[model samples]
Target: MNRVTAWLPDRIDRRVRVVAWLSFLAQTIIIATGGAVRLTGSGLGCPTWPLCTEGSLVTTPEMGIHGMIEFGNRLMTGVVGIVAVLVVLSIWRIRRERRDLWTLAVVVVLGIVAQAIVGGITVWTGLNPFIVGFHYVASLVLVCVTAAYLVRLDAVPGPRELAVPSWYAGLTHATTAVLAVSIVFGVLTTASGPHSGDADAGRTGYNAELLEHVHAWPGYALFVLTLVLLVGASRLRLPVRRWVVVLLLVEVVQIAVGLYQARNGLPPLAVGVHMVLAALTAATMTVLVLKLKRPTATAAPAGDAAVAASAR
Candidate 1:
């Protein structure tokens, strides 16, 4: 059997990689739609826990179109949950090569379920700022972990140890951490501060401008950090993969949209686009980091030297 086909189970014929890709795509859509719910001031449109107003999926006329929009986003979470299960099961059947991938998928599914419960609590408690903030943070974390899982699954056993500067790996780790923190700060701004013209109404706990400024500073720091990582990666002379380029472009677009939203008083459409781009950037970073091979700065054994010379 070929190397790619060797990863499959005898009982299952189709590629597990395809399922993994579909799960990633589904996850991206679900994250984007969830952001839409918050951006459009529909976070509380349902106005009840685990249901729309009055415990109906579609309540009375007073619930209106906004309520339906929110509920529909909620429904999309179920689709993500289904895809997560499929990914997990497909990997489990072929557990020999990629146990970690399946394990992370299992964790992601649990995280999403817990995230849904948190969403419910946010509504039940009248959209308490702290809980809502965590809800958004949780989604970002899920994307990060899920992306890492997907990338590792697709990884080939190339050379067992490709040579790259140790500092590049460190920078990648730092960049990923900063991006995650930036995402949390974003959630804080949206949850605690006024946004979408709802701040004055006391929907969230903090004032709009103050919370926004607090959130904005982290983004500036994160942008600089990402640049450092990117430059350092380029210096290593390791092959730059397609995903890294795509991720950097997405990050640039996300930053641009964020700046526009800030200047335009947080337009809903702009914020929604920013959220999707942020998720994509986060996912792509995960892929890039996973692809990186840290240099040990040690001489190779005779067997390894022979293979390396032959490949060159």
Candidate 2:
């Protein structure tokens, strides 16, 4: 155990940050790829769980391109699992000291496991819109969590001090709330729309056009709220102003993509881009939240026993 500990860095460093970035990137990539699978009508190419097909661990020739795409997506889970294991082990020696790190690492791994099960279920249920929507939303949640983990890695431990006024914090919370509602409506819009993963896949039975408009309401609200936050941050010279700018940019681009998709009758490429931007927007929001506060305590250097103890 000591040798293993010695082999891995006992403290957070560039290598640790690299792993953290990889964790975030992996989730984002998976979201994009999953979008591809659905847009391409490859959701059920393999037609079975655990194995690509019944009694087969790989895609068969008859399954064609769809099978390859779906199987490729399944294989990505293994890649993500490997990265999660690395993240856990890399920080194991400091697990007691950096409880936050190890705990989040475990959650990332467990979340992946749960996602795999959900994927299987989605396939088994013949891509029911609700379950499929849940699966997509779950991926966004994982992206958000991973983004938080990354932010925390660089943060000093202890209660964070607010960088902006208390009301600004409240505004931030409200923005997050509206963002959540918008995401839910967006998911519903997709569930009721034309891209049902498979040809015979069940839809949510709601009017897609109506859901689209409902989704836009909260989205516009988010944009206006975020604009207010940005102007306020800039005037106050708040450190989070930069992130707010980023958030606004993402929101604008996402809105554009969404508009294009709708106007074009929901082209697959536009939908895929919208999905990617949605994940990116979620990550950016997490960053904005973290940026709203500064750590109250100074972070100790990597090998300090006092730091280790405090982290515990």
Q: In model 1, how large is the Cα lDDT of residue 215?
A: 68
Give Cα-based local distance difference scores for all models. 0.69, 0.88
Lowest summed lDDT across 10 adjacent residues in model 2 is found at: 297-306
Q: TM-score of the candidate numbered 1?
A: 0.80
Looking at model 1, residue 82 earns an lDDT score of 87
Task: State the lDDT of candidate 1 residue by residue for 129-163, as single tens digits.
Answer: 67766776678778778788766653442234544
Instruction: List ranges where model 1 is wrong by over 4 Å.
Output: 1-15, 55-62, 156-162, 196-204, 240-244, 294-312
lDDT of 2 by residue, 1-312 (tens): 777678996777767788888999999999988998999999999899989999899999999999999999998889888988888877877687678778889998999999999999999999989998899999998898889889878666555578789999999999999999999999999999999888989999999999999999999999999999999998999999888999999999999999999898999999999988988898999989988887554433433444454345
- Please tell me which predicted candidate would have the highest TM-score against the true structure: 2
Shift of residue 261 alpha carbon in model 2, Å: 0.5
Number of the top candidate by lDDT? 2
Q: What is every candidate's alpha-carbon RMSD to the true fold?
A: 5.9, 2.8
- Each prediction's TM-score versus the true structure: 0.80, 0.94
